[model samples]
Target: MKILKLSYFVKLSIFLILPFLCFGQEKEQKEKPELDLGGALRFNYIYSSWKEEQKTKGGEFGYDMFRINAKASYKGIFLNAEYRLYSEAFGGGFLKQGWIGYKFNEKNQFHVGLVYVPFGIKQYNSHNWFFNITYYVGLEDDHDMGFKYLHEDEKWEYAFAFLKNAEELNFGGDTENNSSRYSYDVVGRNKETNQFNAKIVRKLGDSIQHRIGFSGQYGSLYNIDTNKNGNHYALALHYELNWNKWNLKTEIITVSHSPENKEGQSNKIIKMGAYGAPYEIAADFNMYTIGLSKKISVAWGPVSEIEVYNDFGYMQKKEKEFTDSFMNVTGLLLTAGQVYTYIDYAAGYNHSWLGGNFEDDFSTGNPDANWEARFNINIGYYF
Candidate 1:
């Protein structure tokens, strides 16, 4: 097995600097530390058009996952972590996010550890169970091992982060990039490293709230076989509008990756993985997404409210020879006390998770690939 070599100096620096920043605050009013623990159990039922036998049998229902969430705060320091347990088929178990943060004041805060990359939308780009295509391309809700600084006020918010790499599964010895994890990242013979990101959002209006934001990121792609580094960059413009009970979200993103691969490997595609699988994706592409949701109060038994939504995404590969990808999901979210459920009809063409084959869906997709659909319901109870 090849040895994995990480930049120890950078890791050491972060560990050394965080303690000083977290503890150096002048002693003010002493507040008691607080800790909160919560978790959720979820299940899914799916009927897929591509699965002939399953469709003939009606559908399949099974346990989806259970997850634990922890939050602790003391004075100006805080910690947040989440761990998920999935079936063996879905990457088993992994740490979804864990971070330690320090609040300098009301407007400034710093975070270190496996932190979310501030890009595009804030928490989620879509209201549906299946996120937009940007999630597959590692642009939406992606997290990395990094340090981040955030500043927010009434009208403006800003975030800057320096990410060292994707969260590493193996500490020092193993060379293979593990695919058993959440969130897509460069895998195979290449790894993501030395990434930097910046995001700024401007808030406008009160009742009819509007938010406009810009995000940019640049990172390095380290090829183990070639012993060389390539590069990647992405830029996005996003907008969010909320008026009364109606909400809208939209974003346009352009991403490019230039990987220094072995002589025979094609530069047009790179490998990315999540949930125990790795697949090739076009190295250069543009993505567009838009979603709208409206909430309605309900008097049905045990159901308090329902959110109806539609989310659509389009992926346009930069290379003319590669076929593009499309996805659309129409869904409803029902909330009743501590239980929530999602019912969705999702359709896609050349999408990795939707219906296309893993090998070529996001790569050089077949020109004649037909659209496929899935009807799914997920129910989860939280405490």
Candidate 2:
């Protein structure tokens, strides 16, 4: 039923956009409609080190995601929208991002609608499949429903946003399973409203680029204790540097929040979509991620660029009771034109949401929760 609903909207959007975008292609098009009709199909083979019997530790081929990227402008007014197909519970067809903006000048712009929050080192920060810990915590590349002011110059950049919620159009319904295909409302540990994101960054040096950025967010999280709103604030510092064939990215983030918990069982985890315990509480946590990437140019074969990447993230919950989790991802990526192939591996704690984001590694009985590893080979082609 959920798949049907998502599919309905996806197909409807396709029917509506195709003719309009392709209408003037054959004739002398003045101001060509900037339309990008392409998507990636992927094949994956995965293996789990500890769970030899895990169902996801095998080969699978399916529609990973299909997107329609379209933008048009006349005068100074512009419109942009991207619709994609990918989700956990159902065949999710939703906008990865969409916004309307007007350029005030060469360096200033005002945009409204769904926009990316100014919270990460880069828009798409990671070089591998699994992003940094900020993504797991609902901060990296988070698209929110809101308004924004963005500016960029040679040495400085800024972004400020007033968002209503993260992702205005969410997948329709209650999801018991935690998957990247769906939002992380599994046990409802997080409820967002009236979020404000701010950031400023500057670059120094001429040859070897050195950049530093500061980001912060303040929002209200709905709690069961009171009809009033709860408080949540996050602060992060990011540094990125590139020289020769090597690039390094690092970030340190701190976040604190106090949200109302379910009555009576304030200590127990309210498990629903995820097998792990829920963490919707008044606690603070610190996260740090550092990654290095080196590009090797290979001209002989189909591989145009051979890249090696490794990134690790550590999260320490300041509640003094919660355990810390570690995430390490390493990858070898081969890029040829618009096609990419990669072999990646990740190791993390059980029930801590690892690389195989769809599969939750939770079990019963004989405790001693240990770390697990997942290895995957991915092939993707974008048309």
Candidate 3:
């Protein structure tokens, strides 16, 4: 019965889209050659292997996520939507991201609607259609819901943005009691984040460049005991200097936040969980990371890159004492809350349109969890 209902819905959606597809085709036939109306298709494939530890047993698991994206624009207004079909190996697939936007100026000005946050490296590609694995939107934490601004010229370029809780995923009912086990509430944390961000870039000669950026979010998290306030602020800096065949790149990030537990358990974590647990409380936390990367072209025409990084961090925890078992601390917590060290090393081949992103190894678990690696190859054409 469920499958029947789903099939009916899909048919209805296709029916609704038929008119727009036909209309677009008719417009193209009637318009001048200068009027542009077309869209591109993109494919993404991802695979991961995981190691699990449990008292009874331990084993390995893997999953794959694939996405197909389509986009179209007419004049300054545009629309983009994607369909994700997951294999049975990964449960199933569905639409991942879909939104629309408008271009504001000759320099790529834009006002996006339900669009992907336009504040990342993905916007610029040598192929004009492919993106690097690292080119992710900050708002990827959720669906981008808001506006964007961009400015580009010879010496200076910049981007600014705002996004809401547009792509939150909530599954099933009775979320308050069953969220952790079987449900994914779009606003699972029961919080709405209002984000404001900015990026500025400066060009210095042919071998040197610099970029600085900042992002902030303010919101509230709904917990059982009390409504907790939350906020996140981050600052970023990037610099690159090239000498002959070698290039030096440095990136830095400073982040601060105050978040709460949805189950209202901060107090227990502070008191009985661990001595330094207090620092891990749902209060306030701050961390900073700096990384230096070097890239050199090898005799094989492939570029090799290496990065060394570290994070220094601290936090202020929340306190609570309650008689209920549910309110009591139940797990091991480490306080004194200090990051002694963090680092990662990666060496890989470089190609156009696709590559990989290297991340520091903090190790909650899994070596690859601390980083991401991939091989990408794509093709694109413009008319």
* Candidate 3 TM-score to native: 0.48
Candidate 1, number of clashes:
0
Query: In candidate 3, what are the lDDT values of residues 1-383, reduced to their tens digit?
Result: 99999999999999999999999999877653332343333232222212123212432223223345566667667767665544443335444456666677777777555544433222321111112112211221233556777788777777777766444345323243211111111223334346676767775666554443333344333333345655555554554444443334333434344446555433222110100111111222222222222333334322132222221111112222211000000111111112111121122222111122211111011222222222222222211
Note each model's CA RMSD in angstroms. 12.9, 13.5, 17.6
Q: Which candidate is the best by TM-score?
A: 1
User: Model 2, 42-103: lDDT tens per residue?
Assistant: 66666767555665536444445556677767556688777766644333566667889888
Residue 308 of candidate 3: its Cα lDDT?
25
Q: What is the full ranking by TM-score, best candidate first? A: 1, 2, 3
TM-score of each: 0.92, 0.78, 0.48
TM-score for candidate 1, residues paired by index: 0.92
Segments in model 3 whose C-alpha atoms lie over 4 Å from true places: 1-63, 87-91, 94-96, 114-143, 170-188, 212-229, 240-249, 260-264, 267-383
Query: Which residues of candidate 1, in runs, are more than 4 Å off?
Result: 1-30, 172-174
| TM-score quality measure for candidate 2 | 0.78
Enumerate residue pairs that collide in model 1: none
**Which of the two, 1 or 3, has more TM-score?**
1
